[model samples]
Target: MVEVRHHYATVRGHRVFYREAGAREAPTLVLLHGYPSSSRMFRHLIPALADRFHVIAPDHLGFGNSDVPSVDAFPYTFDSLTDITEALLAQLDVTRYAVYVQDYGAPIGWRLALRTPDAITAVITQNGNAYEDGFVPEFWKPVWAYCENPGPQTEPAVRAALSLDAIRWQYLHGVDRPELVDPDTWAADHHEVSRPGNDLVQLALFRDYASNPPLYPQVHAYFRERQVPLLAVWGAGDEIFGPDGARAFARDLPDAEIHLVPGGGHFLLESHLDTVAGYVRGFLTAAASPA
Candidate 1:
């Protein structure tokens, strides 16, 4: 793993943590991880692509070792996080790049696409969603309910979401079996959450996400009409955002390729790094053609 480094953008008033891999001049590939999982998710994927492309993986403000202030102080909304990403890209002078987004990053990354259409040359999504059909996870109901009235049960739930055990469970529970991942990864993520006050920010982000699902239609529209080449690499065993969710990306993207790993979960990168890396490389190569 690359040593932790900070990228401070006066534009956003926060110091973000990121690790840049491969050569600085290789075509850029920005890897945006999901909720609660930091840039660390790209540990394996980064080295694989480092030989050919510049790989950047950043911890979203609340997820990893980046700045996580009180929920009252920061705009933990999906929209604001998208803005942070845009600013980071601009700060880094990345003009055209492929973005790998997953889970909660679906909305934030899509918002970035909407805001900066030309800057994103391609997309790589694994277990991320933008389809009306992909909305059936039972875990989301509480989040939606809390967003409608974020008063009584909000604090406790948010606290729950941030617990070390909670984040660990979210990462591990749905796997076909426990050996799908190295125990050290779980230990590290759990340790990250064990830090005080991290969980509330996580739950707060989820609570705010309740209102942002409406952005899907425009994202799907852009994918279809704009012909962005998307590689939807998903694990067939993801109970949270199941295989059909992977098909949903293909539905919106005519030029999309969907790859399914028979025994993977929300954290497919943990188990299917080789296939994910292969698809990303191939997709980036094919997506560079003039549309």
Candidate 2:
């Protein structure tokens, strides 16, 4: 069995926590986690892939075990977050690697690829949205409203949904096998997000998320221009990033492999870990084959 090890690196004068497994000589696989979660989300996936790949999963600056600086010191924009993550990867001497992005991880991964084109070997997106068609307004209207007016008046509705109940809902919603869902998943998330000043950090990211959709054109152009290897594995039951978002990848890169996991939800990894792991392992193997 592969052993997962925990370590920390100083990026931009802040301590960032990460999980590492496998030998250094193996191809690197960097896992970027989603909202309300961290490298902790990839705990099982890391060990699953560690036998054949060098897996590294890091918690974004404010999320997970990383140091949560005051908003005054660290601006909570995606750019800033990615900059810190990029610095962390560079500190660890990761020259080339594949990125597995989910939820907020999409923006971070895309930015990493854009910043260092030659560094990214492949892209694996799980329920990570990067298109206009996938940004349905029904679920995002409240988010948009909060973005438009960032204050207490507009925050209650958003706050209500982000409570422990909502965090639990995020994990269990649309999941076919509720028994497979772990209560600790949301419990840990609630503990992290409910930290004294963490709400401000989350809200900042929520507002900054609006900046991502406008860049979809650039992201699409990069996919077409670079002809980068792309694999999209999405949960069909996901409310935020639906099947449409999963299929949109094929439009940009006709050769892109698209898999819509039925009976899976946004937090598919929670319930469908082995299934997604199988897909990832096979995809990486095929991607390494010579044309």
Write down the TM-score for model 2: 0.98
Model 2 stretches astray by more than 4 angstroms: none
Query: What's the TM-score of each model vs. the native?
Result: 0.90, 0.98
Model 2 vs truth, CA RMSD: 1.0
Cα lDDT of model 1 by residue, 20-110, tens digit: 8777787888888886678888888888887878888878887676887778789788888888888888888888888889987778778
Q: Which consecutive 10 residues in model 2 have the weakest lDDT in total? A: 132-141
Model 1 alpha-carbon drift over 4 Å, by segment: 1-11, 153-159, 289-291
Candidate of highest TM-score: 2
lDDT of 2: 0.89
Q: Model 2: clashing residue pairs? A: none
Residue-level lDDT for 224 in candidate 2: 91
RMSD of 1: 2.5
- Provide the overall lDDT of each model, using Cα atoms, as 2-decimal numbers: 0.76, 0.89
**What's the lDDT for residue 161 in model 1?**
68
